[model samples]
Target: MAVLKKQLEDMRGIRYDIASLKGSISNLKTPTARQFVSPRQMMTNGKTPTKRSTPNPIGVGPSCISRKKPVRGNDPRKSAARTKARRRILQGKQISEDMMAALQMEDLKQLCSMHNVRYRGMPQARVALRKIPGLIVSDTEDLPNRSATGEEVQGANMEDAQSVESESEEEDDDSSEEAEYFEGPEASKDVQPSAH
Candidate 1:
């Protein structure tokens, strides 16, 4: 009789499980409806997804993806330094040799660039600094040692042309002297009494 009661209790437990399962099935969404929702939406329970403002993010959409980082022309710190140097120049305090000597090569370059002074091929920073003053004071557009006066350029070109001509003439004279030396000796030797 105890065994029979135990079997009845087991049967009741199985029946209760079946009823709970039916209730859960009724509350659950269909697979087709679940298929319509994105995995993100499903994970979020149909809530709006949050956006991250970082350059790289979890979701890689077309709009969010970038092949390369955006490039900035000038760094803020460098620009600030340039502005400070400019202000110092305006005050007529930083143009002194001692003040310029105190500045680093990079600082001098920034100063040159700020004033649009051409200093690309300058060998020394002091040389570049010297150009900045002429650029500021002179009304002329050209930088010192960059473009010469028209007459100066023409004179230089004429000098170069004359030197080349002189070099060519010297080479011609040397070649003629060598020809005479070689041919004269050979002809004299050939004219020697031929053994009959």
Candidate 2:
């Protein structure tokens, strides 16, 4: 009796499953026949769905896509020549000694003028002028002889020379006065004076 009851239960479960599957099938809506295409037919037709025409080939269309003609009179040769000339000037060799000396003198005059010093004398001027270049000289080894008297010819203007001389004299006087003040009787004032 128990075996018969179990068999009846199993048949009822199978019937429920079949009814649910049938409901699911009936609820599904099939697509129309025209919506489907066979792969063989599409391949045989060799037709592609049309796409919108591409935007007109950018800017001036296909007409301006050709190579542009060269501009007239736009020669690079003149520019090249100018560049060469500039290079030559920049890399040119040093000036001769005479020219260099003259330039040095001119530079000295300008410096002197700026400093309110009167630029004068051929010999003394040259000596002083030589000193000007030395101011710019990087090497002490290149200094002109300090004891060279020949370079001190009597060419410097009298007034200018006197000024330089008086300036030196004044400096000397100041140093002497300082020395006397430091080393003279005043410096030893703390000590008793010696009897005459």
- Find the candidate with the highest lDDT and give its number: 1
10 residues in a row with least lDDT, candidate 2: 93-102
Task: For candidate 1, write residues 56-95 as lDDT tens digits.
Answer: 5767676756586656865555556556555666654334
Off by over 4 Å in 2: 35-196
Candidate 1's error at 70, in angstroms?
Answer: 41
Clashes of 2: 2
Evaluated against the true structure, the overall lDDT of model 2 is: 0.51
Q: Which candidate number has the best TM-score?
A: 1
Candidate 2 structure quality by residue, lDDT tens digits, 1-196: 9999999999999999999999999999998678555454353456645556767755646644688687885546644544443343244422222322334344445545643455465455535534553233333233233234455322234456668989988887777666666776557656432221
All candidates' TM-scores?
0.21, 0.18
Clashing residue pairs for model 2 = 121-155, 121-156
TM-score of 2: 0.18
> Model 1: runs farther than 4 Å from truth?
1-87, 90-94, 120-123, 134-196
